[model samples]
Target: MIKNRDIVCIANTTWFGEYTKSTVQLMSRLAKNNRVLFVEYPFTWKDTLTTFLGKQKAPVSRMLGLKSRLELINTENGSKVYNLVPPPVLPVDFIKKDQLFKPFFNLNVALYKIALRKVMKKMEVKDPIVITAYNPFYGLPLIGQLNEALNVYYCYDGIGTRRHGKRIYAIDEAFSKNVDAIVTTSDYINDDKKKFNPKSYVVKNGVDFDTFYADAKNKVHKNEQKIVGYIGSLDHRFDINTVEFAVKNMPDTLYHFTGNLRNQEIKQRLDKFDNVEFFGSVKPNDVPALLATYDVGIIPYLVNDINKNIYPLKINEYMAVGVPVVMTPFADLKDFSGMVSVAENNETFVKTLITELEKDSRSAINKRIEFAKSNSWDIKAEEFGEILNKLLENGND
Candidate 1:
């Protein structure tokens, strides 16, 4: 419904060859009808240094076409994605009461604003709709300066719960109260944001059905034992304890994890288990093939205030592939109880995994595939487009 308008999306994640997140997926869909400027997270001098030192690899030329401060990326969905590159600035993870970092923070903001303004001028975009997805520190402050028609804040997680995210939560609270519209990924987040902005709405995470829904009979690798798998970043949100407990309890089961290992300590701990295999970070196009090999899918997330609100996309991907899914008791998964098995504790998690592995029936697989079809990224994007259209029509009255 939202078409022919220029949209500027300020995302927290990089637009370069990183794993596609919700913002990337939705914005790409939106770009089919509208001109979209997808802004990547600013690259600092330290980041460049790290890349040069072989600590991190830079995105390939095919993925990012750099033109000074601007990088143009061609998306598969025919969306115009422009990545704005900000000048190097100080890195402050935490803010002090004395506001010593205020000066440098403002400088960082100015650099981003200037870079974005140049892109806007080049595109002849005036009064564009600005969508900021969980980047309060950098993006929210630019709302007034950018002369945007409307500002939307998309909250995907309760970031305050993390040790380094306390200050970010403060910014998120302020941003939530001021943004014209607020979109959240879960009910808990929607409720929390609604307290500050009544316009807040929940738009849950969805899967890419076209890619995920392959033949259920397709197998990427043959395994002697049943493969219980997880396909996502192995970050702090993951409950290593639960995975370890399940592995120990079911030694005969083969556990496969295909994603980047963010937590090296947890990776080292999980490596101790002989039954567990970690295939570090597969390509996005190759995910379905990897998933097809899984007999059962698992979401072993830690039970915390932040994670309790997560509407994971992996669950839908697993279901779309006709693989039985067993997840931890996250509140967002409650609605899918019929399709997914939610375990309350480590013991229950292991038991549920075994149960799901045993009960992988054709009828159940068909039902899962159908459910996933209903929640595809295209459908979710259409729904989101309707909301944006309605909001724009009202002119934020």
Candidate 2:
């Protein structure tokens, strides 16, 4: 493990948020041997306004200067993550032209640097290894300014998602080349990322086994209605058509969802089904038990540009709890072909789901549990640490 080192992560998510993401899970594990700092999402003026208006949930007092922006967060692994909230930035997305938006972009980066530098100096963080987690716009500009040992572009997703707009591809390419290493969560993403940086590596996502494993053993499925659950952010990524087909075909089965519903149209359409139930986002600690109730877990994603390179987190969470897994063939599943069943189209998806419902044996469950145990966060974090060590050893900076 990389011990006694200062690790700074410039990430797109909150330290304590609705979901327990890969960044949070890995960073929390890494913090056991290193001083980790989680730089939260760069909030825009619009985000601040929404938070103020109670339309969004955020660190309101910290954003408003009522409370400190930087604090030490105690993690479950008995390590602390220094979470820092940078100043609110300009919401320049309204300006379509690059020439018009460049000034505001520079201004936001400038303001962000001041906030980050202040916190780093106060905490006496020196020779830190910086990991820019999916914010390539700011990641590109903040390159040589942080007085860091190395910068790892942690590209969990491809560019052009979320706030990474039209110019993200070029910006992402530039940032990838400049960084010491590019770490990805899937081989599909790695194929593109490694074209820019040779140091690119795929440290696939994993589960917190102790929690989910216990959930598998402890929680018994009590419902008479055969439950088919999906646990992830309900967005455009989720295939409503695939879900609708299954719901209509299998009227006896209960369809459950547990994640923040982003696409309202999905809710409007899927809610009309009497069998479908939506359990909105839950605490990270509570997820294992909730997933344990599922007879079968699914990744019903539309095979779009984003889903083509995607690796949903729920796969491991589901398997860890001995739940039979089924999914639409969105990304690479060469590693999991033995354990997870994939269907190419909606009709076949329903068919595969029914087959899963019909035949789930103790051997299959044991195999999945073993797979989950092998791909635990404990193992993934160590794999990541090895990559960090290799980067530092090579003197990539």
Clashes of each: 1, 0
Residue 267, model 1: Cα distance from true site in angstroms: 2.6
Q: Where does model 1 exceed 4 Å of error?
A: 58-66, 94-98, 161-165, 215-223
Cα-based TM-score, every candidate: 0.93, 0.96
> lDDT tens digits, residues 65-142, model 1?
343666666886766776665555556555564377677778878877877888799989888889998887776688
Cand. 2 Cα-lDDT: 0.87
Which one is best on TM-score? 2
lDDT, residue 350, candidate 2: 88
Error of 1 at 91 (Å): 1.3
By lDDT, the best candidate is: 2
Q: Model 2, 363: alpha-carbon shift in Å?
A: 2.7
- Write the residue-wise lDDT of candidate 2 on 327-374 in tens digits: 988888687878899999888988998898778777777888989999
Where is model 2 more than 4 Å wrong at Cα? Answer: 217-222
